[model samples]
Target: MSRTKTRFAFVCQSCGFRSPKWLGRCPGCEEWNTFAEESERVISGGSSARPAVPYPEIEDLSLSRIDSGIGELNRVLGGGIVPGSIILLGGEPGIGKSTLVLQAAEELSRQGLQVLYLAGEESAQQIKIRGDRLGLAGKHLFLASETCLERFLEEAQKIRPNLLVIDSIQTVYTESLDSIAGSISQVRECAARLLRFAKGERVPAFLVGHITKDGALAGPKALEHIVDTVLYFEGERHQNHKIVRAVKNRFGPANELGIFEMTGQGLKEVDSPSQLFLTERAPQAPGSAVVGAIEGSRPMLVEVQALVSQSNYITARRESNGFDRNRLSLLLAMLERRAGLHLLGTDVYVNVAGGLALSEPAVDLAVVAAVVSSFRNQPLSAKTVLFGEVGLAGEIRAVSLAVTRIREALAMGFKSVVLPANNLPLAEGVPKVELVGMSSVLDFMEWAG
Candidate 1:
């Protein structure tokens, strides 16, 4: 009698690690009490395994990149899509990640390039319907609805398209990886295989990935490390505009951004986001002030609105989504202690108009102005624009790239600006905006008063 070969199955619930049966901890990596018993499909007996072949490196001079026909996207991709690159796109659900690539494929295909779009999440009919609605006219664009990795690879080899898109890498699976779809091991294995295929075949692949609840790409930490580029699709759901930011890149500037507005047809480029952010401005409105901030290389003027009201609640609740709340409290304290504004009986509320989460300290001046404007029942002058950093000691501080902010304000037709006293290095030969420099937060309060 011959000894029999056996297969075992196990799963790690904590990290979702699955493997062949019972171990003290997990041989995958030494994590105690992480493994659990799981029922998984096992393969054995009559099977031929092909030896793995290493992908030979292509001569860099021989390979080339093709433009995606979108100027901003080209900038984000470092002047277009490299022939053997693997790019991962991550975003919130229903944020139009799929629609963007679909439109890109349609545009590229119409330009006489062969393209293949593989969607494991959507059916071929569904994609075709969206394409028809988008009014794309091209015989070269192809679509396949498949999720199996082996079949997908085979299909790609047959099609040999100029550009290949997997609607999402999260949906793909490989025979060697026992982990379920979307699991860490599964995503990692699938991505590695796809990367090898893309490199060896000289095919550029675009992967739309699912974002975690924390807004990061969902998968093992290694998954992100495997890709050549990572882009974040960010924006407020209520707003029509979406900002595509490159978080990591090998070929492009890291902070590059592409702005698009979701429309009935598809996403259209927003040439002037400053105009978009301020087009709905309410002139002479108390508690509303314009703030200029830079996102990537683009300068935007967003309005900061605040309302100060009498409140009997002891907590005096401070809340802000796009703007920092702790900073708001410090500003209020400065107003009360140094600037002599009465806030003991008031509730203060602030909002960064357009729902943009502004992180830079540059919004400080506008925030202070909005609060002061509301407290005094006076409207901020429409001709005024502001930027600066506020300090704990009620002192106004210098901010980064001051001249650029002022230049953007002048381009937007704003006549005056209130900024840090120290940040004025004037732009030469340009019609300039009047720069009002202040030394302290108290100075702004006095000015507003």
Candidate 2:
């Protein structure tokens, strides 16, 4: 019996849900108009099957790492890049994803290692122009502008470089799949093949991915799962600072972040991110408060600014930047109910300084303080820092890594810290710092007053 050459199905772009027929809404993610027809080849007679190989002994296997020579990138990758690992780098366009990878490739080439960079989106001349502008013309660095997955893989095999980078996986397509490049089927298959090649050939690979309108990776969800590490480049395009954060890592810790400052030369690592974040902070400004946040194992100080004013419209406006909108709403409600603040006819705006997104519960106290401060038009002491979780019942809660937060704050010359009363005992080492412990939101309001 002969097998069909191709089969088709509707796949949801948002959730990677596969269905035989098209639907108005995806049952998985509930996203509308996200399903697209994808075609895959049907193989017969097991002709393309790989012969089974014996598993290696656990004690005999060894893992080696390569340093990308960029300290910021290395730290986010958990010390160094592991050989045979597939790293998925995703970000918004113009957020320095390509610049970062190209810089790392140049650094790797400088370490006497060959690097194969496949630029599927840009032409060879364009890449050369960028390389020349960035002063990254390395003898060992090889570039090829190809979108065909099979040919790219063939060239990779021929080069046998230490590091392989696909400028973007979305732009690379396979001949076996009838779908065009950037489609779900093509991205999944191309990534699968590259992952196999990386592991089988023991060459580290980096796959650049584009994000969707919803800010998720543009390809199928399987693309993130198949890779060993998923790194996100986050920052505003107009802003000079950028952050590379690791969301998932099989070999190391997740949520690790690396800070960089984009310059005319290239991405420069920020050694003192806390200082950089607070460099331009107005010391005696109302609605501004400093909070220490821990990203992975690193602790840093961030400024939280809020504005509370009379609402012009019937429904009060609530806006937040670099902070959760829902959380801001919750805090506003708590300020009214628990702190005895009259916020009914007010428009509130909150922003985290330096384009830093803070999700830690410890920042709750800071947010409340900033909002309340703005309402009262009182300026918090610039020498003070605060961090704690606020409960719905108006009680302040202790946060993890209290000791680390205090140490960082004190090192930055902040003499006073407002934390949960229960966490006062965690401040054992720092006797020189004054700690004002608050047990509830009511007490915090009084203290701020």
The CA lDDT of each predicted structure is 0.78, 0.88
* lDDT computed for candidate 2: 0.88
Model 1 misplacement above 4 A: 1-63, 212-217, 220-222, 311-313, 326-347, 427-432
What clash count goes with each model?
Answer: 2, 0
lDDT of 2 by residue, 267-289 (tens): 99999889988998997999999
Clashing pairs in 1: 8-21, 9-21
By lDDT, who's the top model here? 2
TM-score of each: 0.82, 0.94
lDDT of 1 by residue, 317-388 (tens): 666757889988888897899878888789999998766767788898899899899989999889899998
Error of 2 at 58 (Å): 2.8
Model 2 spans with C-alpha error above 4 angstroms = 1-4, 44-56, 59-63, 220-222
Against the true structure, candidate 1 has what lDDT?
0.78
Find the 10 residues in a row with the least total lDDT in model 2: 55-64
